[model samples]
Target: MVMTIGLPTQQKTRNNQLYVEHLSDDIQDHVYQAILEGVYKMFQMFGGSLSEVLADPSKKGKLKDFLDWQIPRLRVQHADLLDVFQGVQFLPLDKHAFLRVQCFVNRLEGRFGEIR
Candidate 1:
């Protein structure tokens, strides 16, 4: 059995063909690609499971640097990264405000098809 994970461009391309039998059209959004790239880099540096990697003796120090430094820096650089993969919740707004935004989104969707 095999497992698949995403990563950044540089790491992903290093041995991309070996991982995929047939590639599809590349993802168009730069943000999504960047997120994938980040995941790839983590996998390369820490292996599969984040907890398992942190538990290893050799990886313990690197884990501290990653948790303390890299994560905060990444959050500053990519504010949406943590939120991107999370489940959605209702906006913190009154009913009227929520309806207004929903109405605007509906209009935009009418004009542009769908968001994606």
Candidate 2:
């Protein structure tokens, strides 16, 4: 039996972590494209309307709840991958987006009190 096309080979050892074994340059490119497509799909799935997600009091609070609860859990789940971006870098839009989300979280936390 052979595994191909979006299926990763599984190993019995090492707590069952799968690797993209023997990926050529083209297979690697395919993997990268798949990841980008998935990311955008997720954004669209979670973000119905940009204005609603980024604005509107109720909608904004939901997004803040998601970021607070989920992002830290994701960090725990995928720490190795996230380490690639461990360095601090300056970009206007990135900083703006962070500030917007942070401001929303700050407001929400102040309003609702801490998660504890």
Error of 1 at 33 (Å): 14
Off by over 4 Å in 1: 1-90
- Clashing residue pairs, candidate 1? 7-36, 7-37, 7-40, 8-37
Model 2 TM-score relative to the real fold? 0.27
Candidate 2: regions farther than 4 A off:
1-43, 76-116
Clashes of each: 4, 0
Q: For every model shown, what is its TM-score relative to the native structure?
A: 0.29, 0.27
Top candidate on TM-score is: 1
What lDDT score is found at residue 25 in candidate 2? 32
lDDT of model 2, residue 70? 47
- Candidate 2 per-residue lDDT, tens place, 2-116, comes to 1134434434545577544542432444334444444444555886654667567768776566556544453232333223444356665687898997898888988887632
